[model samples]
Every structure is written in structure tokens, then in C-alpha cells.
Target chain A: MAPPHDEVADSRDRAWGLRVGTEADGTEARQPVMADVARLAGVSHQTVSRVLNGAPHVRPGTRARVLAAIRELDYRPNSAARALVTRRSQTLGVVSFDSTLYGPASTLDGIERAARTAGYFVSVAGLRSLDSRSVQEAVDRLRDQGVEGVAVIAPQISAVGALAKLSSAVPVVAVGAGSRSRLPMVSFDNRAGAEVATRHLLDLGHRTVHHLAGPVGWTEGRDRQDGWRQALEAGGARVSRIGGGDWSARSGYEAGRRIAHDPEVTAVFCANDHMALGLLRALREAGRAVPGEISVVGFDDIPEAAYFTPPLTTVRQDFGELGRRALELLLEEIEGVDRPRHPVRISPETVLRRSTGPARRT
Target chain B: MAPPHDEVADSRDRAWGLRVGTEADGTEARQPVMADVARLAGVSHQTVSRVLNGAPHVRPGTRARVLAAIRELDYRPNSAARALVTRRSQTLGVVSFDSTLYGPASTLDGIERAARTAGYFVSVAGLRSLDSRSVQEAVDRLRDQGVEGVAVIAPQISAVGALAKLSSAVPVVAVGAGSRSRLPMVSFDNRAGAEVATRHLLDLGHRTVHHLAGPVGWTEGRDRQDGWRQALEAGGARVSRIGGGDWSARSGYEAGRRIAHDPEVTAVFCANDHMALGLLRALREAGRAVPGEISVVGFDDIPEAAYFTPPLTTVRQDFGELGRRALELLLEEIEGVDRPRHPVRISPETVLRRSTGPARRT
Candidate 1:
């Protein structure tokens, strides 16, 4: 078979040795082939191809000259067969937002680690926005790369609709996806985590808890809000809905400042730890003492969470598990098994930090 | 031209619809080719090829049946052209360690975002340790994919040596890499951050500052220790080094408790915010009040840093900048530009939180 376009081009360049080449100049002398390397290295063409592909059982000296000849000839292996038996590009495509938010970043790291452990390459694409077009474009680009599998780190609600339009030609596992997705996914149980944080505050004897949530469109926002609501309803406590904000410490602080002004709000559950940090700042500025006059709880026990004053009482999401599971699902698809779609769900655990305490007497 | 080995297999599987057909014999039948899909869909083979390759100008109806036949035949495109034009697998390989530390995770996110923006696929390989053999094996696996470029997120001292072995084959960029690497690299300025943090306390009239460093073997640990030493020496203030710990809150707390018991230590600078938090807990337990009796400063102003009781005063590394810069460098290499080999260092800024205050009279 003739070499693919890239290998042919590379081999042609290698044949030139030091000759300049450009796309417009299509005519070029072809480089030495497997036959040429075999002739020089005193090996069969099959042996040369096997050495080029790093097939396990070659003799040591034969491997060396073949490698030297490859270095001299700059022989490039055919990628098509490599993708076949391996059933992999050894590459993972990660679709994510462009922001530097803590949760997405952590999840990306875990995904990278898991993929690396499994001996796959990782490529990342960023969605400029959560719009359908942006997501579709990202997916299209990843598909064009001949990726074996894709792990989407999209957290926006729009991602679900956009991803649904994606071709299921390859296995895709989404992280922080909406609860309703048919695609295999791995995510932290946000709703349960929110409930745990809320109950911890309520158990501290606070009459009611104020809630500051992430943007309503995010899956995390919806799930955390749901958990907080369910916890409040279960306790028969009036759920005072505070207005929404973005997932940032600055937003949390703004929301926290607003809640601090209300005399009846003794405890509050912010959607994430960053927001809680902001809320803590606002509460302090508003002359409300943490765990003394007011208690606060946060979610996603980020690395910096426990360092917050009164150490944040928050929930921890095992991002590593999410990353590992997402890769596993993608691999399963690559392996071409007709296994039933088994979506993996990881639960969040709450850590008792110093941020929550018994409600102060009026 | 024949496609690269991997692409050929992928295309073959799709063209033949290997997933859809079965054989009465134990051996499986190859999926039908584009010729079959074209025959099945009542379109020319050229039209079927165009539809499969996503040619932009195809008519909707014609595109639809061709696509339907594609779903029916599962025809896949030949990877020959892609392999030739880009000399790219259209895949990027990333190697990282297993820990879920905040900095590395966030940096990975930034790189992933950038890779997506550039229209490349990502594959990740995670290492259990930063040993030479493991890193080499990981690199070899990535090389087997014929990756055009690679990014390694190794933060340990041993990782520096491992990267040298990976330098010859691909355009490798090391993230969180030490100064010793000759390969192009991007990293945060840990030393400068520590100096600025320590100086802030000294400016507040502290005679000396105690240190809580990360594990000694890591680049971060070494840079931070050097920075602290340089600052104390530069200020002509007393310096004391405490036994180091990992970048965790528990370790910080233990170090903090030990420091708090020594009345001479009035100000402390921790390697990271998590340790600062632990230090705070230890300080409280030891009856040393924050800012009143002891002042503290930390690095990596994570979101929860502001929520730490009295809020953590720390240094903030712009991870977004780090990610963007790394991407820019990688692209430059891919574009074959002449670039300087100096370590591109990003300066971390001091975030003034409430954790540090003026020193009190003894």
C-alpha cells in the first residue's frame, strides 16, 4: 500500500535531506522506503515495519540499526493500522469552557491523570461560550482529529442540547452534565452534597438558612439549589430564596453581604466554596461574626476551603473518580463492547470545618 | 494514498460498518465500503464520499440520504490527507501525576482549553510517580500514537530528569517543570511570591518570619524555601526553618502548632494556602491569636483563602496566564519559529487578605 499523505510528505522531505519544501511544490523525490531500510539494515521489510511500530519481539541489534536507518531515512509509520489493533488514537479529547474556575480545572486534572494512567494522549478544546454552535464546533473539530473517544467537561445547560446533536460514532463521556443526558456520564452528586451542608447548618440550631446559588442555567446550580430546597422542606424551615450569582468568590461575597443585613438569617448555604469565601468577607464587612452571629456552609471543598477562617464546613467532590470513570466509559466504547450504558454517579461527602456553629441568641 | 495505519483501520471499520454486520462463520465480515453505501443510497460514490467527509457545499436532501446510508453502511473516511498536511495525529499527548492538587489541575484546564481552541485532539497519560522508567514508558506510549506534540505536567524533582529522555522525539512542553529543563517550559514564580509575602510581614514590623514549606524534593518546595531564606537574609531578620509537609491543610496545621508553641515566632509564611489554614488551626489551639499575636501569609490565593477566619493573606499565581503562555509556546514550536530557551517565569502577586497584620509588642 502507498504511504498516507503525511508519511509520504515526511518521507519525501527526508529524501531531500536539507532541501526546502512547501505545500505548493507538490513534486518531490520520494525517500527511501521500508525496502531501502531493510536493504541497508540487512532485515526483512516486515521486520522494518514491525520495528517502526514498536512491536515487542525484535532482536536487540536488529532493532538498533533499523532505528538508526529510520533516524537516517526519517521513516514514518502508517497511523491507520496503529489505530486498528489498538482501537485507539491513545488520545482523549476534552471539551470544556475557557474559564479558570476551580472545579472545572480540578476535574480536568483528574481526567488528564486518569487518561495518562491508561496510556492515552489528551487534547483539550474550549467552548468560548455555552452556546449550541460553540459546542457543536468543538465536537466537530475533535471528530475531525480521528479521536478514539471524547470526554466533554461542559457544565452549562446548553451543552446538553448541543451534545445531543453530536454523532455517537465514538464513545463520549460527559462530566458535569445535566441529570437527564442519555450519554454515559460521570459527575459528583451535587444535590446530595447541598443537602448535607444544609442539614449540618440546621443541626447547629439555626432556625433558617439563606441560599446563594450559582447561575440557574448550570447543572451544578440546579442540583445544588434542589438539594438546599429539599433539605429546607424536610426540616420545615422556611426557604428564603436569595438572588442568583455567578460561581465566584466575588459573587458569593455580594450575596453574603445582602443576607448579612437580614437579622433573621443566622445560617447560610452558598452554592460553592468560592462563593462562601466571598460571603464570609461580606458577612465580616457587615459586622456579622462567622459562627458567632451567623454560620455559613459551602460546597466543593476546594483545596483552599479548609484554610478559610473558621475553616469552611463544605462538601468534597471526588474529581479523580469522575475523571477515571469518564475515561473508563470512553475506553469501553473504544473496545467495541455492546455493554449496556452504565452511567457512573459519584456522591459528595461533607467535611466538618469551623464555619458552622450553634446559632447565636437574638 | 493509503492512510496512516490507525486512520486506515478507523476508516475501514466505518466504511465496512463492522459494528452493524455479522457473519455466520466465527470470523467477522469487513464492513461494506463507500461503494456499498453509495449503491445502497442511490447516489454516486463521489457524493457519498463528500457527505462522509462533511464537505461544506452539499445539498441538504442529498446530504441526508448519504448520511442515512452512512449510518446504514457506517462508512469512515480515509485518514491519508490529514496525516500528510498536518504531520499531526490531530492528537496531543498530556502526562501528569495522580494527585489532585489545585495548581496543576487548574493549569491543565487552561492548556486543555487552549488545545481545543487550536483544533487539536487531546489524550492524557497519568503516572503513579515521576520516576525515569515510568515517564519514559509514558512517553513511549504517547509516541506510539505518533503525537505531534506533548505536554507533561510533572511537578516532582525526579520529573525534571524524565523530561530529558522525552526531548528528542516530539515537541515537548513541561508544565510545572523546574529550571533545569532545556526543553521549552512555563511555570509560576514561587520564589518571588515567597519573597514578597515575607517582605510584607517584615514591613509590618515583624522581626522574623517562620516558614512552613512543602516537601523538600519538589520544585515548589525548593523555590519557596530559597525565597524565604533570601527575604530574611535581605531584611537582616532572623530565619527559622520548620520540617516541611505536603501541600495539604493537615501538614500546615501540624507545622503551625509547632511554631505557635515557640513564642519567638511572631509571623509565619506557609508554602501554600492549605498549609496556612492548618497553621491557623494550630495557632488557635495553641492560644496564639491571628494578627494580634501572630501574622500569617500563604501562597496560591485559592477562593477559600478569603473565607479563612481573618481571611488568608496569600500570593496568587495566574494559572490562566500560565496555560495561555504554555499554549503559545507549543504553537510556536509547532510553527517552527526561532524562540529563546530561557524559562518563561510568571510572577505571582500578593493578595492582601486579613491573615497578616502589624506585629504586636512582645
Candidate 2:
């Protein structure tokens, strides 16, 4: 939404306040390509293309016409050749999905901050899907702009593979990507965080914790579920599993409601904080008392977690740390330093809110 | 945060599932700038700059020498001229701060999505503060990049003034900015959202409602307090305001605990939902049964809102909508179309959850 016209006019004084430099107009007029001038001047296409590309063999009078024609028409040179020669488009291409989800957006902020500090500009391209074709198309566009390097922030399992191919061509970094390839990568320890949450519940004397996992295709979702399963198996507790969920609070609520209504469920761990929030509501509506009958724990101690009714007990992953480390690894690679191939794991801490408690006396 | 190398490698095959792109030689030679080529060619600096810019009028011999020098040095002309002719960089600069707060991050995502759809790339510059120097420096850097326009997501009152100065030279749209200036802007009706939250509590039959606010300098903070004050005045009820907080759950928890310690506080409308979550915990700790004793309503129906132990009844703003609208307005201005200057106020919807109820009769 924009402000009214009159307000904009009034604020025009405020508007022009900080601009520091101006570009020359004469230089812009001469930017027309040789082909454009040649077409206007009635020359062969190759002749015009040669004139624009600065071929030295053009006839003297023909060169004058080409120059005059170039002046008459305004065209910008192809960005590709310019990018190839300058080696500094001062731009960094960022490939990501158009998502309202918290993780990707936060990582983007981190990437943008890191890029700015390094004095480079950012050009973002969003992916419609993690398929190879979509990834390739986006990559081609970035390459067209002649960006110095690229950063892919998609968490889909396929993205790592898509990125592995891209890494050998350009300096590429993947946020929340697994450490499978030799290409540099950075991500949160999803499995460890989930394990911590599950173990916390078990330590409180809960028999076992049920899991509501994120979509299976994402590494974070799978790792978290694995962590939950690992903890349950380590404790010799039965592992009951629900099939799937998108990373949404509503899905969590639905999953939570089902767990609450079930007689066998005594404790539950949600994949992320948003889902845990939903589950909490579902449990309440089912006439269950949190922590008293069904102890619940969540991941990603988002800002809202502490405000949750019982204050959610959840594992907190530092996304800022994830981003910083990713940038560090990428910069190191960019500077031609050889870092270890092993993935650097940053563990999340458990925030003990009032939501988790000992099992019922049944 | 990343996994072990073998795990990432295995995941890559599962995700990408195809042979990686063939590796091309990553060695691309750097191009020389006009400044460097001019020195080598022994021509006037302007002649070398002009020859590279394709400016006519250089003699055949001089032009030939310049061309030879350019080829030898692999000279690359600066591509900044796109700004002069089309007056379009096809890029929008986004200035923001590092915040996981729902409003700013959501707004950022919305803008990015909208910008991508408009065929414009987004360059984000995340600042740590909204101080005059910080805002000025950020805007300056974007201007240096020759960005056609910019969108600032800074909401601090201090930024309002700093950004007001920034809009004149460059087309800028300030999102979640203060409305003190006539500069093109997009923001939510924080006052109205607060009024609605407070009125909802008042309509629930509470004699009086207590308020918990965010930091003092933010525009949202001020607007919410104003709305709370206006609602109290309209109801002819005495206002009881307590502890101020930053927009964090921990801060909210402290404020909530303070409010819970007060026996007379029956109804509370927190400035934002995260804080409301904290209040719920404090109330529970104080042994006050929600609705049966104390009632709470929050603002901003964040994803986690519905998942609160008792679902949270709060006001929700569509960040995606706000972001899209802001971009549309900026584009309108960028394209030199006449646009109104009145700030667009998107109404926030009240989401009814389980957190609010009729006040108990004492």
C-alpha cells in the first residue's frame, strides 16, 4: 500500500533528502548495440554486430555511419559479456523458494547481512519447486546476470543434489543443507535438537514421546523424527508414529488433537514450535490437562514459545549461528581456503518451560 | 547444524537423484576496468572511458589504439548506465534489521515475493539499528549500487525521520514506518488493532483491562498504547497499565508475572501475542484459572497462536498482503505514475481462539 498523492508531494522534500550522486546522460545514449545502429543505418546484421563488438576491420566511412547510427539509437550491451570481463558484477545471486515460513526468511536475512558486509549486492530468484528443471532455470537467470557467486536456501532433500552440481561451476553455499557432498554447507542440527527434546520428556518419567513430523522430503523433518525415534528406542519405549504434516500450526493442532483424544498417548513431541502450539490447543479442546496427563515438548523456541500458556518446553536452534557459519564456510571457500569436508553441527539447548512434567500415576 | 559428510552425500542422491552437472573449468579470467586500460593505451582518461562507453568522435588512430589496449587488457566497461536510459535497475533495495519478530520478517517475505513476481530483483540490507547514521549509511549504500528504488522496513520513530530524508532523491517506500512524514509508505493500523483487542476484552464484561506494551520508541508500540488508552476512555473505565516489555516472550513473561502478582487485574490485552503467551504462564503460575478468574487477549495471530494450550484469541495481520501492497506502490512510483500519498492502512482481523472468555462475577 502507498501513501496518497498529496502526502507524497508534501513529503517530496523529505523524499529527495539523501541521494548522493548522479549518472551521466551522454554516456547512456551511446550504449545502443551495433546491430541496432546498423539496422537503423541500413547495414548488414553482421556488419552492425561487428561494429558494436569493436571489430577493427570495418571501412572508415562505414565506421562513421555505425558510430552515427549508434548515437541515434540507444541500446545496452549484452550483460553476459560485461559480466565475463568485469569479473565483478558486484552481485550475489540468492536462490530460494517463495515461502512465508520462518526458517528460510531468517536465513535470507543472515545471507543479506553477510553479503552487505562483504560489499556485494544481492539478486534473489525464487524456486517454484525443488525439481532439477526449476533449479536450473533459476540458476541460468542468475548466471545471466553474471552474479559473482550463488546461495541456495531451499531445505528440500533434492536441493542438496541440485546444489552439488552447481557448486563445481560457481561458488555456491546451501543453508540448512545436509553434509552429504564435498560442496560446503551449513544447517541446524535437527536430529540433535529433537533428541534433546525427546530425552527431556523421558527424563521427566514419561514412558515415550509420540512424534508429529514435518513433511518427509525435508532433511530437518526427517532428522527430527529420527531423533525422536532414537531417544524412544534408547529408552526401550514403544514408538508410535503419525504419518505427515506441513510446517504449519494448524497441522500441529490437528495432530495434537488426535493425540489428546487417544487413550494410549501420554507424551508428544512436535517437529517445530508452530505445530506444538496447534497441538496444545487440540489437547485443551479434548479436555486434557497439559503436563498432568500428556506432557508435550516442541522444537525451535520461537519468540512466542515462552508466552505459550504453560510456556512451552522446547529445543532452541540458533538460526543466526547457522547463517553465520554458512557464510563463514562460503567465504572461506571463496577465498580458496581448504576447510574440512565434515559438516559442522551446532547443537540446540532445551528451554524448560512449564509445559513438560512427570507422567500420570496410572 | 549440518550433518556428517557421508549423511549429506547419501541424502544428496536421494534428493537430487541424478548425475551432477558436468564441471566446467571454474577458472574465468578477470576483465580490466576502463581506468586500467586508459593508462596502458596512453590516451586521455576521458578518451579511454569514452571509447569503452562507445562514445563517438575519437580519431581512427586513437580509437584503434584504445581498442588494441582494451583487447590486450581485457577491459570491461562499467554497467551502471542502465540507470540513466531506462532509469531502471530492475532491482529494489530492502533495508531492515535483524529481528525474528513476526511483523518485520513477515513483511520482508511479502515484499520479496511481490518483487520477484514483478520481474525485479531484491537487494536486502539488514541493519542492526535504526539510528540516523545507520539508516543513512544503508540508504547510501543502496544508492551507490544505483538501485532504481528502495523499501525500508524500519519501524523505529528514529528511522521515520532518517528515512524521511532518504526518499527525496530515490523512490522509497517505507513499510511499518512511522506516519510522521508524507513519504510513500505502507503500515498496519497498530492503534486500531490494539483498540480491537482492548475492546474485545472490555466487551467480555470486564470492569477494567490492564495493558502490557512493547518498547517505547517503536511506532507499533506507541500506536498500540494509544489504542488501549482510547478504548479505556471510550469505555469510561480507569486504565491500569503495568510493566513495559520488548517484543519477546521472556519480556512478556516478566510483564505477565508482574500482572499476575496483582490480585485486582482481571482482564489483560497484551500489545502483541508473544507477550500474551507469557502472561498466560504467569497467570497459571499465580493459580488463576483463565476466564474463570482472568481473561487475556493478544494481537498478531502468529502461526503459534492457534496452538497455545488454550487457543489464543488475537488480532491477525496478513504480512503477505502488506508486503505485496508496498511493492505495488513502489513500482507505481518507479514507473513515474501519479500515485496518492495517503498511507494504506490494512485492517487486522480478530482471530477468536480459546484464550478469551466472559469475565467471572466476583
Candidate 3:
């Protein structure tokens, strides 16, 4: 349906417009079509279209004239008309769950910046749950809104299954989903990051690094655990799972209280920074000096991580880069590029800080 | 324009439908209109409308028949049709800046939850800058996308001015903008929160509290500073201005390094918890014992605050409540409720933790 007349008036008032050579009565009027720009520039409609579309083979003088006409007419391309013609909305949808979390939130911020830079509007569908039904509904809603492509920040196992089952024609990119999925995905190298963190502790002369894992069902947590186990086995150190956290400080504190009681636990690796903060508190209360008696490390160098007591030695994920690469992959699919389907894995860098030190002499 | 045929087919495959009454040829067909349900139910169209709208006065038996017919026909109320008839898109647009920050991010999460609970979809236009042009463009973009109302999370001073001058017909509620503007707003009591944090430090027997202010131009920062000054003046204590932070840990650390040199500084209040974390780090590195040589406090008891070194004593702003209230006010304006123009202020409470204690006996 055509937009209401008032909406048109609102757009006219806000849009940039110029009073160029105008009507037969010598009065300036609104220019609503490409023909008006072509007429004012004394150029053919095909020339104007070529200029607008950046088509090759246009003369410099003709291109300059078309540009001048566009500016003079204050002619902004109508997205609705363009969508109708090309069957594209030039809009990307982001389906994010629990965006308040640092990982998801940072990823989303990156996606928005990248999408906007590529001249696309981002419509976010925030889901309250990671259930398959909720994921499917959110995708359907975005599709109904005419988004040409979608980026799903699906961090959970169930969400990956839902993405595989989705039948929408719109191209989809799943952020943070493991590389096992059939859909295009961009993710931080969780297992590799964890391996580096674990190796850092082993290099410090610690016998083994006790793991405080994130909750089950999260691909990140599972991958991190796998990396930690692999590092321990390769180092010929005993692998012991102290406990896990729900990626919350309270849960970390609860798990830390148990780990603090074990005299053999000299080094600990937390899945994320928030849990590391809680572990620090529990260790301090238990009279264990950070890096003096026990070395600690965490993942996701969030903004506050550097300010943690003694500063956290953690792995930093370049969420912005991850988000940008995700958009690039999604756009390639949207633009119908027949590229090979390979997941993009962004490497994480380990940041050395006061939180990790050489293990105490036996 | 009508939605393409494939979209309809996709919806048909997923939508709930069951064959019941048959046509003259004894075959069930697609039902796309309310009249089809009414015909199958042997009821008037008005009765079906009343049942769908949950309007009172429909007989129980008639309502049941209409509901059954609706189920059998898979009569999903079309949002486009409803929007055309009622001029309501059932969507709320949120204009947010720096959504990666804890306060703005939390507020946005809250608003999304509240909007979803109200059966509305949230379309977020995340601003890259708080400039008037950017603010106006975001609002215009959302309006063009057909949001029924808007919640502008305009914490910056210039954004409030932009919101005041907005000419769009859609109703707007400015969240976190100071109450000085003509538009309705919902905000955490920044002044009260700062006042309480300052008073807590002063009441701890400190001669005066040094302030780590947030950057200028943010109404939240300005109000927090005002509250801190008011508390100091009310207590008849000397006020000293330490350096300010840009609500970032790096800035806070830079400011903290400067504050650590002053021998007279016994207590300090940071604008937010992230900055407080930096302050703690600086103090520890300077060998100043927390709550022994100096006491510290902060505003915005973010989730990680309780796990900070020694746990931070801070003011808690209910960002979720603020967002929920902002949606309520915007919805009221959208529904044309005759209400006063006063802004809504959500109170903040001081959370006492290990970060603050009695000042040292100098």
C-alpha cells in the first residue's frame, strides 16, 4: 500500500531539497522522481540511472551533470520504490538473545556498526529465550518485516538446530555458533583461546589448572572445556573439573568457595571475566594471594577486566571484527555470491597482566 | 504493496489450521478474511470481531463458536490490516546511544522486555553519535519504518534538544534525559543517587569526599555532579574536584592515578562502578588499604559491582524499571491519554558493601 499523505509531507519537510529550474510557471516544486532530475539536468533517463547505479562507461561530463542534478533536485533515492523493483529491502535483521551479556552485546554493537557502514538499517529482534520456538518466531518476524538478510547471534546449542531448520529464502549468518553448523557463522576461537590460557598457567610451573566452566548448552563453554582438557593432556598434567558457573559472579563465587578449599588447586581458569572477579573475591577471603599463591586467568577481556583486583590476565575477543566479518559473509550470500561455505573464526589474543604469575616454588 | 505469494505460503505452512466446515464442493480452502471465520461459525462478522478483540457482551456460546472457527480457518489477525484500520503498528522504536555501556544497555534490555510484554515489537536505532543531526535522522528512520511511538534514550544534553524539536506525529518519551525538556521522560534519580553515594562517604567521618565526575554533556553526569556538590555543601564539608572520567575504566584509571597522590583525600565517589573498579586498582597499586586508609563509593550498582575488589559500595539504579516506565509513558501518549506533562523519576537506593567504611583517624 502507498504510504499515507502525511508521511510523505513529513519526509518532504525533513529531506534535503533544492529549488532548481522548475515548473512552466517559473515556480519551484517538489521533485519526486528520477525523471525530474533528468529533465533539470538536460540528460536522458538512462544516463541518470547509470549514474545512480554507478554503472561504467558514462562520460565524466555526463556523470558530473547527473550528480549536479541530483543535488540540485535534492533527490534522495526512495527505499520503498527500490525495494519494490529489486526485491531487496537493504535492511538486515539481527536476532539476539540475552543481549545484556557482554559477549552478545559487544557482538551486536559490532554488527550494527558494520551494517550501517555498509548502508543497511539494522532491525533487532531481541528474544527472551533461546528455545527453538522463540528463535524460529524471531526469524519469522524479521522476515515479515522485509529484511533482505539476517544475522542470528545464537550462542546456544538449541538455537543452532533451529537455524538449520529455518526455510526462509533470506540468507542467514549465525554469530557465535560453532563451526559444526551448516549455516555461515562467525565466532571467536573459543577452544584456541582456552588452550592458550591453559598453556599460560602450565608454563608458569603450575601442576594443573582447575577449570571453572560456563553453564552447559553454551557452545563457548563446551569448547573452552575441551581446550582446557586437551592442554592438560598434552602437558601430561592431571585434568580435574573443579566446578562450573552460569556466567554470573554469584555462581562463580559459589564455585570458587569449593575450589578454595582444595590445597592442590594452585591455578584456575575462568570461562569469563565476571566469574573471575567472583573467584578473586572468594580467593581473597580464603586468604589465598592472587598470583602469589594461585595464578588466575579469564576469557573475554571486558572493559572492567583491566580494573579487576591485580588486573585479570585474560583472552580478548575482537567482537567488532567478528561482527564485521559476519555481515560481510551475510551480504555475500544476500548478493548471491556462490562462495564456499566456511565459518569465519576470529582469533583471540591473550593479555598478560598481574593476575598470572610464576607458580610458587614447591 | 501486497506481500509476495511465497510469504503467504510460508505463513500457511507454519500457522495453526485445522479443517472443519467444508465449502459447497465439500472441500476446505484457505481462509484469509474474518468473514470466512464468521461464515463457518454461522455468526455475524461483528461477533467474530468482538471475539477476536476480546470485547465484552459476546455470549459465551457465540464466543466459543467464533474461536473454534478462527482456529479451524487459521485466522491470524494481519498486522498490516490492523495497522491500516487503527493506525497503530504495535511497534515501539527505541533510539539508543552507546548501547555497549552498562546503563544504556540495561535500560534498552528493560525497554525491550516491557515492549514485548505489551505485545509490541521493538525496533532499535542505535546512534553512532549524540549530535542533533544523528538523533534526528535515527528518529526519522524509525518513523519511516512505521513505529507507533518512540522511546528516545537521550542522556546527552544535545539529544534532548533534538527530541524537543522533533516534528514527527509519533509520540515520544525521552528516557534518561533531564526533566528540563517539554517532552515526557523517565529517568533514574541521578541527583539522588549521587547525593546518597556522596553522603555515605561523608558520613564515614571523612573530612571531604573527592569526586570522579563523568564527562560533560551527559545529563546523567551533570546531575550526579550536582548531587555530589549538594551533599558536600549540606554536610558543611569542603568540596574538592578530582579529575573526571568518560564513564570508562581507562579514563577512571587515569583519574585515579591523579587522586592517589593527594594525602588529604580520605574518601572518593566515582560516577559509576566501572570507574570505581579502576579507582580500586589504582589505590591497591599505590599501597593504600581500602576502608583502612581510604573509603570509596560509586554510583550504578552494575551486576559486577558486588564482585569488585572488596565489593563496591554503590547506588543502585533500577534500569529495568526505568525502561518499563518509559514505555508506559510513551504508550499513554500514543493512546492519547490526557495526563500531566511532569517527568517520572525512579528513585535509587544505596547498597552498602565492603568498598566504603569509617574514615581513618587522621
lDDT of 3 at B221: 88
TM-score of chain A of each: 0.84, 0.76, 0.83
Please report how far candidate 1 places residue B251 from its true position, in Å: 1.6
What does candidate 3's lDDT look like per residue over A1-362, in tens digits? Answer: 01223223333232221111235563445534788888988988878988999999999998999899898866755455555455556678899987888877778888888887888878778886879899988887877666778899988888998998663445788999976788888898899999999999999999999999988888888889999999999999999987889999888888888888788989999999889989998998898899899888999999888888879999999888888899998887665565567788999999999999998888
Where does model 1 exceed 4 Å of error?
A1-81, A84-88, A98-102, A113-119, A203-205, A335-343, A359-362, B1-81, B84-86, B116-122
TM-score of each: 0.78, 0.76, 0.82
Writing each residue's lDDT as its tens digit, candidate 1 over B1-362 gives 12222333454454234433445653444536678888888989889877866888889998888889888755565343446443556566777674256676567667777776786656566676667788777776776666667788786778878787666566678876766677788888888888999999999999998888888678878888889989999999987887798888989887876778787888989998888888888888788899889999989987667767668899998776787788778776555555467878999999998888999876
Clash pairs of candidate 3? A1-B1
Categorize the docking of model 1: acceptable
Best by lDDT: 3
Candidate 1 per-residue C-alpha lDDT over A204-318 given as tens digits, one digit per residue, 9 for 90 to 100: 8888888888887798888889999999999999998787888888788788877788888888888888888888878878888888988988888877677666678999887
Candidates' RMSD to native: 7.6, 12.9, 7.6
lDDT of each: 0.76, 0.74, 0.81
Pitting candidate 1 against candidate 2, the one with the higher DockQ is 1
Tens-digit lDDT track of model 3 for B152-227: 9879999988987663345788999975777788898899888988988887889999999988888988899999
Q: How accurate is candidate 3 locally (lDDT)?
A: 0.81
| TM value for model 2 | 0.76
DockQ winner? 1
True contacts kept of 2: 0.37
